[model samples]
Target chain A: MDLATAGLKTTDHDGIIRIDFIERNILDEANIQLIGEGLNHVVDAMDEPKLVICFENVEHLSSAALGVLITASNRVGSKGGQLRLSDINEQILEVFRITRLDQMFQIYDTSAEAMSAFS
Target chain B: MAESPGHHDERRDSDSSRSGVVVLHDVRTELDSLQRAVVDGIRHAGYDEASTFAVRLALEEAVANAFRHGNGEDPEKVVTVEFKISDEKVWIAVEDEGCGFDPDAVPDPTEEANLEIPSGRGIMLMRAYMTDVSIVAPGNRVEMVFRPAG
Candidate 1:
């Protein structure tokens, strides 16, 4: 299922799914649910064992959105897959750094670098 | 930006010259609008970008806690939010109409065992982003302050 119509764009590179946000901020509860669903769809459709979420345009993310990301990361991990985040803004990066989530996920400067890690 | 009209009661104290009060019901959907209002007020007060972001993060966490944990997501309850911004600092208080918990008892999210847990990070983020975070009025109210970085 392509969740791009649902506010998220997805691309598959050799079985590694890269999900991008069409919106700037995933702060509200409804958008969080949509992002979660998009992630779950990507995870469920994964023919390979890796998933990458790109935050290229996401500048401000609420903690509720962080909760969704955490849940998605755990879900992928439980399935013997990996989740990576790339191109996160500094402001958003500060949230991850403050919460120490930067230590949990493999972060890259760009989506290309993140995708290349799967090789 | 001027205040957006909604169901909530809003008051600005012209005498004090630097305060705004917004009382909102515990409706989850209102969080985004409330956050935007607070952030706008802070920015309009001449706060720098970093300071505004800090205040925004802290205030969001506090209100989220009031709605989620304190009010248990009950829409019938109310969350009272008051903010005062000055050249020195921004002070915000959020009160919920539900039983409150001990802030000290919240597990540290940065701990090794609690890293993957999703729930406990709100308080930690509030504390980390704000200059000071204190539970007042017998834990029913959270008061946070953010000062401009020197």
Candidate 2:
């Protein structure tokens, strides 16, 4: 699959940007760049009270990808927003489990569920 | 087989019964999903626990290194991974078609300045885990071997 076809989008609601990423295969700099760039766009606007990044369709995630997620989460958290994830598949979740990262990030089963929590 | 432990000898006999390699391509988007296929292909051939883990760790490190460093954000580079399992060990090779780097020149991560960094650990991890590790032909090839213990 092409890197960009991974599905990255964001929406602004009530001054909060909700970034969604759908990735497959090995997530590296190229794919994470999509997430980074999208988040940066929202961060630049600085109009959001909170931000959430929802990962969907991502099957396998590498440490490199995790690094990017952590970086994005830190950036959002520093700006008074939160970087959250939802719809994380089982295979991808195994990596998080192995690394004990499940406790480090807020995860949800659906984007609506995550957004509702923010609301 | 002649000098191995009782169960291990039998295991070796069983292992020799099936041995081969699996080739996969275009499944880059589903690496975890493909892992099962790759792992199963090796274990089914009768590699032991330690050997299997060694091969798996090496493959993970190499493929990841290729995806991040060699491919360099290009999905079209076509990272190819192949593995061969035997009674005594497993050999895994990951091939990437990108500009190469000098492996010998990499700064030791154990050094104080690089200890906290994430970028240079893959190769070190592979070397630490695999029984034999080598970079071939301008870094385009990585061959690792996991020898069975006793």
Candidate 3:
């Protein structure tokens, strides 16, 4: 499943998965659908729930997109796995802070940090 | 260019002319269809992706405001939108038929009192995304502008 049409790529490393939103755009419905669907696929393919989603190139995000992120986080959490965010741009991070979702999910400044934190 | 009241041209190519008037309509559900149409028009006019998204979101907030507050959810009324692009600037105006609102009266979203509230952020978001924003219809019309992305 395509999580975003904006050229996002997924990678698996040490049971930690990283999703990079390759192109820069707000994480709106179109891309969210892709992200959500793709995340589900990746999780299903994994034997464990340990995964970290890294929004590498994303610059802005809307509330709708955040909803999708929360949904993915919950899915990972329910399976006794972890969901993490890393490399989030400041503008998009402000939206997360404003919506108070920053408190719900663990955020890191880099992918390695997120993967290291995930257990 | 002004045409006489008696003159009518059905195929004036106004959408492409860039010289036509853009009307601003109030925010209302009845105008939801129209708002989508305007966004379609903007897309058809070849605006970039970011601009299109910004305008669409801003238009939704504006129309929702008109519906929930301005016209008091009156379905019979109408909200109008008019816009034209020229000299690398796109001007958009939205007008509602509802009682006017005070821009100053709106709570600042950044203020502590308004931070948790969802109602006050729409206009501020519009202002942040658009190059210019103004209330022209007193109680009804909102106008915004964006410079065409190079």
DockQ of each: 0.62, 0.08, 0.07
Top candidate, metric lDDT? 1
Model 3 C-alpha lDDT per residue in residues A1-119, reported as the tens digit of each score:
55445356777786677777776653543455566677677766665577767777675565446656667776676677777888887666765665556777789999999888764
Docking class of 3: incorrect
Per-model lDDT: 0.78, 0.61, 0.63
Write the residue-wise lDDT of candidate 1 on A1-119 in tens digits.
55765578877787777888888765455477777777787777664358778898776777777888888888888888888899998988999998888998899999999989888
What is candidate 3's TM-score against the reference?
Answer: 0.52
Flag regions of model 2 displaced more than 4 Å.
Answer: A1-6, A26-30, A47-49, B1-60, B66-82, B85-90, B94-150
- How close is every model to the real structure, measured as TM-score? 0.89, 0.52, 0.52
Tens-digit lDDT track of model 2 for B28-134: 44345445554675677777655555566557778877766777747555666656666566677777767877899877755656433435656776776678898
Ranking by DockQ: 1, 2, 3
Q: Which portions of model 3 miss their true places by more than 4 Å? A: A1-119, B1-36
Model 3 backbone overlap count: 21
> For every candidate structure, what is the RMSD over all alpha carbons to the true structure, in angstroms?
3.4, 9.6, 8.3
Question: Could you give the DockQ of candidate 1?
Answer: 0.62
Going through the candidates in order, what is chain B's TM-score? 0.85, 0.77, 0.72
lDDT of 2 by residue, A70-109 (tens): 6666666677767677888765675555544576688888
Give each model's clash number: 0, 2, 21
